[model samples]
Target: MNFSYSFPALRGIQAGREFYTVMCPLRLIPKIFLFDEEEIPAEHRAQRVMNRSRIPDITNYILENPKDYIFSSLTASVDGEMIFQEHSEELKDIGYLTISLDSKFLINDGQHRRAAIEEALKVFPELGEETISVVFFHDLGLVRSQQMFSDLNRHAVNTTSSIGILYDHRDQLSLITKALISDIPLLNRYTDREKVNLSKNSPKLFALNHIFNTNCRLLGKRKGEIISEQEKEFANQFWVLLCNTITEWQEVLNKKTSPRDLRVNSIVAHGVFLEAIGIIGYYLYFYHPDEWEKYVKKLKHIDWQRDNKEDWQGRAYSHTGRINKNNETVQLTANLIKKKIGLPLTEHEQKIEDKLKEASPLGT
Candidate 1:
């Protein structure tokens, strides 16, 4: 490889700063070894590696301006000796990319660069033809690699967007949302406001958003602290309950003798309805999703307390709330509550029982 002769050390250069000395003007002349993909195992390669649809701008920037790149000076040593070898004919013919067998610190720290190179090389086969200079440290341990990866990616601007998170898990989230919306007839003619509202107002969405955000936060606290099996189970339970509750509420609204008021409704009334349905829905979605579907249908047959004009008097207010569970609206009828959210509840009982049969044995 025709390595650049003048290797310069770039420190934090200020506007008025004069030119300074290079860290290794004592150059370890560049050379090449036979390209060995097996030198670094594939599993140890990188994390979250995937086929990116587009080349990130930063990768292009690095490729175009390789000299601007800086490396940790000590990364050149391998087993207490420098491993900077001379360039072979094959390495010289294509000197565009470099490997860092010397510094696990650099590899861990430069994951974005490494990931970008890996992805970019896939589409641009010519990248494989190029052999760029890499520094490898032979003795860097796992703990050090972990620390390096953490430090490298932990820049000040490390925030991911809500849409980014959504897109990241789109496959799972989309499937679930599609299934729920499909099953709920009321949501068939769904509006964006209603969808956003559903995402915001529905108990299932609320619990789901909480679970997702909490899990993300936990992982953010430490590199490997992802959601545990038990927490995942709880979240699944929460999802089931929330979806069922929304469906049931829709059914109840369909039976109203008066106008519906999801917004102007009392927080206590909404919470009672939401919590009660969520508990029941969670069980049913798993144990008897189909039976639960039938049970939801039967809700339209009964008259709930809110369906009566006398019971709903002075029930609503200007603002719906998050707390204040004491505000009285109206007691859901014993018969309807029993039929909808409560028991003898063969239909409801059957829903969960049937679901249990279909459910997998839970755990890690």
Candidate 2:
């Protein structure tokens, strides 16, 4: 047989199963790896039909930022024998693997990456030289192929958002969040980027998303949104003053109050409180810019002490009997804080406050 498509490969054995690893160039991928959508209806097909929509974003991400994106090796099952031609008689049987194009090759995983590499090659022809590792195994018919697909995905745990932001440098929000963590001592010391919810005993005062999202709100931006330099400076100023004004925050800064106790006993260390403060700060920023610092001093007056459950449970946690972070509770909190400091409430705020006032205040 004409072995014109042989690749220098490493031969390996796992669980008594023989597999071959080869680095396949981008240009040869489409020709060698066959994804049969038609085989899907036959139930004899090993791979599922490709989702056309997912390929474009992946291709675009690669093309837009060619320097940073990574595509892991593809796991494929060959329709015929993967014959590893021996190197020499004196050496072991390990040698180059000759895979033929004459037989079908089904991709058990990374079908999307294969499609994206093909698309990226069209846009950037130089990308054709780029190579992706391919792991080839014996033709495990349709049933085993489908099982392989399931087994591969079952073990894959998606990276969490905090971890994603921790590693990602491309998104503007992530960049700003990273900067804030670096510059703000409180955040740098007490933030948990890997978790969205800080545990009761966690030393963290805020989740990374909470800090990032609250900054978005303070700038009057949407979730996962970007902000300008002016808005960023304003948010920074707000944080500095808010921390300075809030005694608990400063206490944490001074080693006087443990973040764990503040988190367990009060709402000061929670996202809802930060969000509510962001909402209040929005009003001060817009209507009272000249008086912003003066109004910010009002944070000290907030009865953040959690033993005041009489006020907290009814206004913030009355619905579910726990910290409810929905818009309604957050608004009620914003209203309560605004009123405590004698800021005029909007009609919506007044209405929410009236409802909270009507509910029996939570018992201490």
Candidate 3:
């Protein structure tokens, strides 16, 4: 006289332990699987506490792209017995898994996805018909469940920013970056598309993420903003003009100098300077749009050596000579670039420059 829930599942054995993979309806997710409430302490739970802040972004993703969204299988541990009934001897592992209604179902991983699913179902109940896979393992105890959680996440590493930008088709900036890399021969030849930090011996001059970020600044586009065709053309023209104007960039392009040596000796070869250039480009685009080329060509006259302490030390690098990539340093570098191009700084830029002068009266 016991009630039970049954699911079509595929049985499998892993490290001498039996497990089952089952397709679960989204509607059943909220009713059957259980997660520890926020009140539970670390020692008593198998998984980390649900990150409430992350739920909305994920739920919005599901809601925004219902037809194309994908979610990985959820891993859970059942704290009670499961009965697997096979079709026949020929297909012993393929059948139905039945569990009593009284058993406890605990989520060991992917608690966020489960929470998002519940929220999405509330908004669009038709999505409840969709199925998400769940891998169930027998819960040995708190220790075993904790070990499973640890093992599951120990090898998980997030993708590098460059690779993320390279693969992302949804972000307009990512798409424009990829297009820039393709259209500009200098970038196509020397841009590192998959790594964030280039090694000492790496042949590439700039990271893909750096290009994306600098372009975002140059166009003054916020994240997820729609980019116009004219803006895309302007970005292409600006970068191409920049590559031709910068003496060292042209040197590296023509194989007259090595990227390693340029990176070692020049601040202009770094991402900070790339971003500084973008900041300057923003001002030029707005204030001197018709004659920005005349100002940009003046870049060839400026000293970009890392050892040029009077110009670069406090702006592009710390007093200790280490390159700094903070916003303040980027702004400081852009202020110097604006002066070199004979462009006037905005009130905000002038204030930042004034503070630096007050802090270092001797212009150290």
Candidate 4:
């Protein structure tokens, strides 16, 4: 097989394992990759069967946004040893990698991304120059190649939600979440910036993920919705007023209560309640604009004490002892606040409330 292809590559080593990094143009990727599912013996194929369903969303993501997206480095097994040719003394650090595949190339990672890239090309073929990083491993036949696949995934841990929020610039909600944490001192001062869950002794008040989701709800936003400047300002003013009005939030900020104590003692410190407040805030701001501040006062009356299990049990927590964080709980919490403030539920909310009248929703 005349399988020659060449590209400039950077040489790197990890724990004495050698790998070559190459920037392959988008149009060339599909041509170079050969999914193992099609030709190889079942025992020899290191990759899972390609899930065609996942490709379209990723393909649309590339086509729709066109820019500001990420695809992690694709890991593939070369069909044969690739040769590195030194080009110049001045560029000793980089060299051209040339490969001739004697057999079908195998992907140990990023198979879905590879499939999506190919699909995306059908519509956005002009993105031919766009590049994705790839790391090549020398072929090790069937058994060793399978082992490599196992090893690659075994060490891969999903990125934490907070870290994703902190690093993502593409998602509009991530940007708003960052702004909220920066603009609201209370959230910034007490938030666990790296994790989604707070440990018992952690001084941080909430997860960055939690706040992002809560604020999105408050803005009446579905995920990925872009907010107008008016909505942004509304968010800024509403959250500041919320912190000022929620008694436990004020006590935590004032040092009258420690973050750990607040976390342990009150439902208010949980992200679930924050999201519930977001639902209420959206209703008040969207429908009762004139009475939002007045409604904020009603939040202070909630008996947030953790010992007040009677207060949240059937309303926010399930019988098996779990905080219900779904839409049902959100409506329930909104209804609770609506009752306290003497406001009526919207027709949609009243319906949800009626169905959930007897129990709290559960399951993570």
Candidate 5:
């Protein structure tokens, strides 16, 4: 076999059933091995975690039929003395599944498999399995080994983050486009810098994606096509309007005596932004463009209860906060749209505004 690894260790230790040890300067090495399929040993096979069964029927399987699992010679090696000191000492007499190997001591593909085998052997003292079968890489380093581990485990039968999941399956243009479009509302509420943060790490992005993709169990429709043309158009317009709205919101947000009242951290804007998109696109689509623009600009410039970061936090958790004089001005704009376009508002929202108007005459 043409091995990419150099095993000078072979000269130091006899390559037989006994373990070998050698020493060399640190570098990189890669190698490959072929494994044979055979009947799993009774003791080893019983050790497999197949469902909830606690005891592996190892002795029975080994006694009844031992010819099914085949064992192969390990074609692994490491920098002789260094590996003996740093890595292989753990393997002293401990038998393991030698599946394959790659650069810098990369375990080819059997981490879980090896783990299960070890777990089984640990519980069963009769197996006498000491050394695990592992291939060796002469060339790869620690960083590359970590990256390889990530690649293998990412797809190895495990649950992962939605963003991580999204990134992996994002080769589909439709999915990527949907993710970008759906995250706008969240990106808007936080400052522009906040948007970047959301794009990279925020759950808001995932939440919006869930809502947009209708991935929600209660609200989403899974049977329909990925994204309908009407939905696409709605998404496009919604993004455009939200971007403008956020820009306007910031202009007002900065002018407040204390912008903390606005509760920028809350998801209120997500709901409001969603509602506004529906209202503007579906109901008030034909409104006078310039007049609408002027009103929006004016709304953006208005100072209100939303000026407080605490208020923004309250809004995040569904608290509308007190409608002081400053907030009433901003509330009026929202109320006017609700009345003029006949946009839908939940009873709770109407009550919130009513209370605000009562508390803050200036806003009314």
Candidate 6:
């Protein structure tokens, strides 16, 4: 004798195939649905291999925001016979689905959510009562299942980093960056809030994500750290002072120079320079706390022209003169700023500088 599992479901048809939508309790998810765990080759598997590294972060998200976390419906395929009992002739689509206990279930998507839910239930057992919607498709062969996965993800696009920073409410750095742009006149007038990369004629000096990253570096804080009011005020002051001190920044603010000309003529208008400035500001704000303004004013004297190859090549720009924002370049750019301000380089920074000197003895 075999037992059966039944669910109240709504039937639907797509591409001439029938599917059922049902609400499954969180507690029942781990017990019923299955994922391919065998170490099989990629071509033989219907789904991509599970990325274990992503599970903990997702689990923490669910556990941390127990009351307000949201998840989209899970999609799965059933590999056995299913019986649907209609309530009435007119309500045929709204009915109950019953399947044998021996049936195999394969998750077509939302495998990470399933793993996270399983982990969350261990700590918060009461959450087991909550229900999540599941869309069940009849067991097609592995070929069809792979096609379904491909078709589902084909058009999905990841949101840009700038927009992510613009809309985020939880990360303190994001909040601080937004507040800084609104409060600082130069930033308010020149920052691009939506797109990460500025087109040639875009007129904006910096992107929202770039400023957010610079703020993170300046504050010396991690992504989600709780920032104090004093810290927020300090960040505001730092940016305002930077706007007033940097020659090109002030020129743009005064309308004496257009953003396009500055972007084309100077490396300072780029995101790499913004991040390098953040690194410089970090040292000024923390180590030279009492006399940072004096050092910050020195930035105006630095040759910001893109053609100043002696100072900028291999630092702000690649040897080919293209702007580069890799870690080494940002650090090299910060080293130049520290030199201009008469600040001592850290041992790591000195080593990088030493290597550069070995590569280019005449400072080409």
Computed on alpha carbons, the lDDT of every model, listed in order, comes to 0.36, 0.80, 0.90, 0.80, 0.36, 0.89
Q: Write the per-residue lDDT of candidate 6 for residues 186-233, one digit (tens) a residue.
A: 899899999998887888999998899899888888777888887787
Tens-place lDDT digits, model 5, residues 248-337: 344434553222333343233333433333334432334433344443334343233344443332222233543222233333334544
Candidate 6 residue pairs in clash (backbone atoms < 3 Å): none
lDDT for model 6 comes to: 0.89
TM-score of each: 0.30, 0.78, 0.94, 0.84, 0.30, 0.95
What is candidate 3's TM-score against the reference?
0.94
The better-scoring model by TM-score among 2 and 5 is: 2
* lDDT (10s digit) by residue, model 4, range 239-328: 888878888887888899888888777788877788888888887888888778888887787787756765576566766656677777
Q: Compared with the true structure, what per-residue lDDT tens digits does model 1 show for residues 214-321?
A: 233222222223445544444444444434444335544465411134323422123344433444444454566456655544544443343343322222211232
Clash pairs for candidate 2: none
Model 5 weakest lDDT span, ten residues long? 24-33
What TM-score would you give candidate 4 relative to the actual structure? 0.84
Number of backbone collisions per candidate: 24, 0, 0, 2, 47, 0
Choose 1 or 2, whichever is better by lDDT. 2
Task: Report the error of model 2 at residue 121, Å.
Answer: 3.9
Write one digit per residue (lDDT tens) for candidate 2, span 1-364.
Answer: 4755788787788779988888888898877887876645856666677888999889988897888778899999988755688788875555788866576788999999989988988889898888889998898677888888888898899887788878877777677778888888888888898998877788888888887767666777763456688777887788878777988888998999898988877888888888888898889889888888888897787788667876677656654557778788778788878878879999888777777667645411
- lDDT of candidate 3 over 1-364, digit per residue (tens): 1788899999999999999999999999988888877788889878898889999989988998899899999999998879999978999999999987888998888899999999999999999999999999998998999999999999999999898888888878889999989988889999999998888789999999889889988999965789998788878889989988999988998999999999999997788999999998888888888998998899999999988988998889989988899789999999998988788888999999989988995864
